[model samples]
Target: MQSHARGHLVYAASGVLAVHTERGTSIVPANRVAWTPAGFTHYHRAHGDTDMRIVFLAPSIARLIPEHPAVFLASGLAREVLLALTGPRNHDPAAPDYSRSARSRLLRVLVDELREAHEQPLHLPEPRDDRLQAIARMLHERPADNATLAELGKTIGASTRTLSRLFRNELGMTFYEWRTQLRIYHALVLLADGHDTTQTAYACGWANPSSFIAAFTNIVGTTPGRYRTSRRTTARASQLPTVLKSPD
Candidate 1:
């Protein structure tokens, strides 16, 4: 989880993975992958039985990706390339020269695939100021806390104006916007943990399920029900037997 000299791509063939870095935190589901540039201090946590795969990139290749941590949609080709690189068949130290050449080609393909993929809006930027951090910690611990920004500011010994400016200048988002993003992040985790929409809505501070669905869909690009269903489907598929003989 510590910073490395080489950048790496993290993907989960199933389940969810959260990557926390100085720049932000990325929530990566089965269909997405996260890229951490070299020399970034980061850590990861898996939400379920994750089939995690990682590929380290040389400085030259890593430069092609973003300087900051990012999340991208894992395309079909990208997934295949990742599996090939991390699969046991590709790990022989004494493999023939041709095998090495094949691996090199696959690595290039993987980088190219990532370069062309669209980035996902799965990142949650962290606050830097001490007061903002205090407010963030409180909300993170209790996502359902519906305190107004003015109310939260008073508790943190900062006026509403100061807090608003800090949120805009430091986080590049309004306080409300930041809170909504945080709530959505928590809602994603809860949903992945098998909480239904109504339960997730209340847990994340949404007064109504409809409002939660709207916000979740806006940020995650899918409704809560669909997202949860997709995760379950992927889990089931991963658990299926590799070979099934057809009846004669």
Candidate 2:
């Protein structure tokens, strides 16, 4: 958990990463990256054995990015540049004279590529009001809890109408909409942890697999099974050691 004066791009070379900020939480997998603007208080948590890579940008370059935190797809060129910039040798503090000119050029290219990358629908916005916060916490702690807003309001001592208004005004979404987003965010973590679709659906408060699949696909751009499979594939590939053949 940390924030810095410098804005940075965060990438996960092998596993899933989640970036939590005031605006929302963004999930980064192998195919995507997250950008945290300068002076923003944010924290990251790795979902698995993650190979996280970060590139700090100067204020001038950082200003070109979104002021709020965002998640972007890692383009082919961006991925290559990221690997080059974060590679072991590039971080050698004593090797100042090593390809200084080329490295600077690569950094510019990386920023340009990221600027054009499309934002993913991975952000889970937070609600600021105390009433909304309490509701969010309850849903977060017990994702499987299927209590309706009216039912929840009884426990929290707020009218269903008041809670609904707060959700829209603070979070810019209805109670149901916000709850679905929360469930999807939790679903991502459960799926990454290797839960099957049916189990994840039930755990995330979906009444059935079909409904869950529809919601997950609409938000995540893929089915739960596909998302899990992709994560597993990336993890296994990252673990494989490089092999070199003897000279013939």
Candidate 3:
């Protein structure tokens, strides 16, 4: 993981990007934008064919956003602004170089749009307790694991009640909720990798595709089939500090 002096927003033009931090993990799919605040230690992993775009925010602008990492719905206007500020369209033969003042104005607009956009629940908060960590590792390694909290606790040498309390205190969610999110994250990667809905459903531990479909749509706002076939909108790169480096 690496820390940056400037806060940055990343957009996945296609595929999915997972932003891992000490706090937990944030999933960035095509329709969402992810923010990592300045000085946060983070690393990224790309799933499938990804066209990840990144824009760094200046302190003046960064202060307007939440101090913690966040995932926001990328509204139509926000998406366009991001693309105009960073995509190939950012350059113009008529304008030659896009001026700093103009780009800054665009960024202000982008921030305004983002402020109006709903923050999403794409974050999976990390667990710090030893028992919770053990449980988390177990689920992460095999999202297909259908073990109950009691069963998981048994393996970790923790009581189900104790583990339940720890999950609430440390991760701010129930075991089932956390597991569902973890499975969704994995399902997204599988789908991006060209796995069909049925395959992904089972791979992520769903007993049936219908169940997986419901859970996926609840979080992602779309069915897996449609989501896989959807086209990517143009957006993301920087140096006003709107630089586009190789995603890795």
lDDT of candidate 2 over 137-192, digit per residue (tens): 99999998999999999988999999989988877888988888888878877776
Please provide, for model 3 over 33-152, each residue's C-alpha lDDT reduced to its tens digit, 9 standing for 90 to 100.
999998899999999877777888888998998899999988878876776766554544564555788888888988998888878889999988888888889888999999999999
Top-scoring candidate (lDDT): 3
Model 3 segments more than 4 A misplaced: 89-95, 231-248
The number of the candidate with the highest TM-score is 3
TM-score of 1: 0.88
Model 2, residue 227: distance off in Å is 1.8
How many steric overlaps does candidate 3 have?
A: 6
Tens digit per residue, CA lDDT, model 1, 127-226: 8899999999999999999999899988989999999999999988898898898898888778767789999999999999999999999887789889
TM-scores for all candidates: the values are 0.88, 0.87, 0.91
Score residue 50 of candidate 1 by CA lDDT: 68
